[model samples]
Target: MQCHQTSFTLSTAGRGPLRLTARVAECVRDSGIHTGLCHVFCQHTSASLLITENADPAVLRDLEGHLTRAVPDGDPRYTHDQEGPDDMSAHIRSILTGSGLTVPIRQGRLALGTWQGLFLWEHRAQGHARTLVVTCFGTAAS
Candidate 1:
């Protein structure tokens, strides 16, 4: 069995989902893991990972809208607002979602559905650089 790990950095514009399937595929291609499980993790507490539709922009927009409504910034009831209104809310959103995802790798490519894509969900209001770690574990083809 072989294990390969790589990290990529993405600069998010704001509160939204950033598609990263292509980047992750490139990493998997470079890793030379033909068949295995690829674990993608976001090394942040305010952001999360998700696998959703990539064929349409409306799907992402709807998800963002729903999250916004579910966790509004200021409610006057949050006491952990020392970092700003979005601080605690961002953490809460991350908790509600997730921080990592594992996808199958086949033929040196991610085994995602036709419309499925990996995304980094940025819950914060400001633009920032986010890091994602991609780890591939499997047996190399002979």
Candidate 2:
């Protein structure tokens, strides 16, 4: 058994999904771990990770729109607005989504669905730098 870990930072343009499939794959390849698991984690409370469709932009837009409707900013019921209207909402969005995800590694690469892609979902209204920690564990490739 083998384990490897790495971390990287990404700047989000705010309130959208950023593709991370290729970057994560690089980490997996570097780890030399085959037939294992790759876990990706977001360090921020307001941002989350997702594995969704990467083929069409409309799917992302629609998901974001639905989240906006479900977790609208400045709902008036939230009191943790220390960072402005979007602060609490961002936290809510993160909770609704998640903070990390795990994918399988096969043949020293991510064994994801053909259309699946890893994404960093920024729930804030302003751009900010986000850090991600990726850990890969399994048998080292021969």
Look at candidate 2 and give me any clashing residue pairs: none
Off by more than 4 A, model 2 = none
Angstrom error of the Cα, residue 70, model 2: value is 0.2
**RMSD in Å for candidate 2, one decimal?**
0.6
The best candidate by TM-score is 2
Give the TM-score of each candidate: 0.97, 0.99
Score each candidate by Cα lDDT. Answer: 0.92, 0.96
In candidate 2, residue 27 scores what lDDT? 97
The TM-score that candidate 1 achieves is 0.97
On residues 1-142, what C-alpha lDDT tens digit does candidate 1 reach at each position? 9999999889999899998988999989989999999999999999999999999999999998999999999768788888789988999999999999999999889999998999999999997799999999997777
Backbone N/Cα/C clashes per model: 0, 0
> Candidate 1, overall lDDT?
0.92
